[model samples]
Target: MTKRQSRWAKALALCLLASVASGCALPRSGPSKSEIYSGSVLEDGDAFVVSVNDRVTRATSVTPVLGFSSEFLNAGEVGSDTIRPGDTLGLTVWENVDDGLLSSAGQAATALEEVQVDGSGFIFVPYAGRIRAAGNTPERLRQIITEKLDAQTPDPQVIVTRLAGDGATVSVMGGIASQGVYPIERPTRRLSAMLAEAGGVTVTPEIAQITVMRGSHQSKVWFQDLFADPRLDIALRGGDRILVEEDTRSFSVLGATGSQNRIRFETQTLSAIEAIAQVGGLNSNLADPTGVFVFRNEPESIARAVLGRNDLVGDQRMVYVLDLTEPNGMFEARDFAIRDDDTLYVTQAPFVRWQKTLSAVTGSLTPFANYSQLAGN
Candidate 1:
């Protein structure tokens, strides 16, 4: 070959080698490990965050409402206060009339295990056969027993007492120790006590996702409020079933984005622009300015009941395509909202993957070649 042609060929070879060895030529700074999808940017004026008292605006209309209610109370509304027929009572009643001494004679009178109250709320004893004990205080029962025994034994000593019934208990299932029934004493008013009884959530109970089911209705309480606010740690009731469920709702970002992987969106509303920022913004080179896609279920499903049918726009039900190439598009990207469980993927240029593979191969070859050359020397 001519000297000039040979020189050109050498230069080209060196450039090619450099491109493969360093990832600089791949367009994007680093090889992306994700696949991008298509989505849209919302109009700039449409996205905004509404404060609790902020006046409703076109932008604020899309924001979600945040508030507290009994259903949202962490401790949940006080369970039914009145005792029911099937309700189990963890009782501890004591009676020692006449200031009785602790002698062997009174030892037999001390009722121990399995001294259960029948369905009619009465327990029969040696002298006070079939005495009504349930619902009455230990003192009242003792007075009644004393009056009854007086007729037989001439001021006969009498005692009335009740202890926690082993059978009557509330079960704390899911995300807690002692996942079975816990004998309830007194009326349960605070939720934390029950949790403590059950060993306090298996692992924090995602406090925000906790649920309490009394009969049909279920209440949601955030753990933060339970401790931070006194109202959240409300008392519990008998037969109340508490469940510290996992927070199943979340979002994920993929492709040529700043942050990749899962991002939790616990609040009511999440927008596409917010999701992008959560993933650290798009990698400039790998991101296609013209073809950004937000993959989400039809907005009809997202805001169906949230916005109602009359409020939905024609584009609400369609997947939005956002062109982030222009400044206006940036504003629109900001407005395009994302929802829970939505996935945002920013795909690299199709050719980027091939370059990544080549770079890896070349990186491996250089190490092996250097090892061989040193050994040969």
Candidate 2:
């Protein structure tokens, strides 16, 4: 080979090496500064901008009852008091007018003091059999039973009574202290009473969020509220259930942010920033402020439905994205909430992976001792 050709080859090799190294500076396949500031990913038409400093306003709009809007408004009531089908109905029958003879009287083993509406929407009674109790009030049910028993008993003195079933009894599920069914038969029995019956919440504080489902409506009940207010401390029903989810046992928090760990929280509601803080903030050397990503679980069906597909019904339907690059981002972290089973992912800066690749290449070129030294923390 000619000397000039050899020199050209060496020069070309140097140029190639330089280009490969500088390629790390290529525009990253990530959100840029402009995109971070503009929030272009959010749907424009129906989206609401929540600034870091925006005053947090909780939803106060109660679900409006269809076909009863006028009646509900004219009654000047903000919330409905009418019992719903899934709502608990506690019936207490006074045992005064039982048959005088032992043969006719209700036996302790046979007589049901309380009945629960099963999945079929029917309450199984001792002798009267399964009654459609979902929509009927205690008085209405008593009347129905009275009419049914007219042929057997004369004058059939029947007394229909209803006490609060909000806290009649419930079983503690998930991560609770003493997880079991408990009876709470009192007008003022608070949620603490039931939790106390079940021992208490699990030892871990990470999965401490308590959930209470009343029929079809599920709502998050704060640990404090179970004992805070008697009024808000809803009464338990026969079939009511209290689920005390464990703290985030295995979760990932990422971002231009805080802590990053596979941590658990006893409560379900964690703020976006709080989750980041839990994991350990962005690696100062490798974090891209504009490209922070939170890879949360999205309900496939809900997403499809919201995207205009009607076939997907009753699916969990939305994704939440938070950008912490804003000036007042800390407050947004405080107000931006999170749900259970969510994943917060903070993508590494482009230079980080490049550094890792370089380290690996160097390790391969070195002796075992040098490789170990490079890998040593």
Candidate 3:
């Protein structure tokens, strides 16, 4: 062969190999499993290559665990009948005799409306003087007013009604169906009921998060968990603030999956099988079942459990490997839980690179073959 043709063939092979082996520059979705391990901090490269097994699945099945604390759940229940300062009271005082102390010249009864309780927890009635109304119930206040008016008028009767007030209320904010202050009534004495009273959340229930802030204390729970586990509903308190927002937890999919995108968790607990299904599963033509990987920076405590060693400190970079071709491979994947911020990746089959090389070699050979024919002529 002439030197010109020889040089052209050699130059073509070198260019093809360089482009095919381009780590991040290639058109491939991402690096293969072996390429990912080379990025480990350890020299041996095993620090990032943990195999998924029963022990690993159970240890790394860490999901977002959210709920109200004991203090929030164990709070004393407040009865809706109880009155408080800032609450408006409506009273109707009836007397047997005409021209009574509270009544007009001809009327036997007098109606006192919009009588709001003072900040000091006291309310004033014409004949009853000042009475403490904050801690007393409406029924109890009726008895007190009746006794006071009885001394001035014969057979005096009283009826008390509590109006919608700022006394015992909750301020709901964020993506709720309605954002405003809702009164804590008999129908909305609990967290779930109060949320329902606000017309439910604006976000999907699967991704909804309910946060309750009472004074300096605050607690949160997933909207789905609140209904699944009744204990998370918790009791509502006066002057409490509630917020219904979408969950912030998410995971990303890369490599040879059906789709590559950052996906928000739609379920309370997401398994590997389910996460894979969320992205439309693996690409049948390019995926390598044996190279499924999950990359995450796990807390030191979890890293210890996964590696069965305590030497690692702080958060450890972990890459768990899953082999779906094994006998119980699918079962292990089903049990493994995908956590927030974790990256699920599937490498292309090993032979896929060779196919590219073959294509490049055959495609380039045509140009070289034509040059050889020209040289012969």
**In model 1, what lDDT does residue 9 have?**
52
Ranking under lDDT, best-scoring first?
A: 3, 1, 2
Count of steric clashes across candidates, in order: 32, 33, 0
TM-score order of candidates, top first: 3, 1, 2
- Using all chains and alpha carbons, the TM-scores for the candidates as numbered come to 0.56, 0.45, 0.88
Query: Candidate 1 on 227-308: residue-level lDDT in tens?
Result: 7677767666556778876555577776677877888764445556667776677787667655565545444434344333
Task: Give me the displacement of residue 178 in model 2, in angstroms.
Answer: 2.7
lDDT of 2 by residue, 196-282 (tens): 677778655533557776566555544654454444455444556778874343555644345545666535456666666666666
Highest TM-score scorer: 3
- Name the candidate, 1 or 2, with the larger TM-score value: 1
For model 1, the superposed segments whose C-alpha errors exceed 4 Å read 1-114, 186-188, 202-208, 252-254, 258-274, 277-281, 289-293, 298-337, 347-377
How far in Å is the alpha carbon of 285 misplaced in model 2? 2.7
lDDT of 3 by residue, 1-377 (tens): 77777887788878767776564334577887778778765656645678899999888877666888899988867888899998999999988987788888899889999899999999999978999999999999999988888888898989999999678888999998888998888888998898888888889888888899988988888888887898888888889999888888889999889999999998888888899999999999899999999989999999999888879889988888899999999999999999999999999997886676667667767877787878868
* Stretches of candidate 3 exceeding 4 Å from the true structure: 1-26, 41-47, 150-155, 365-377
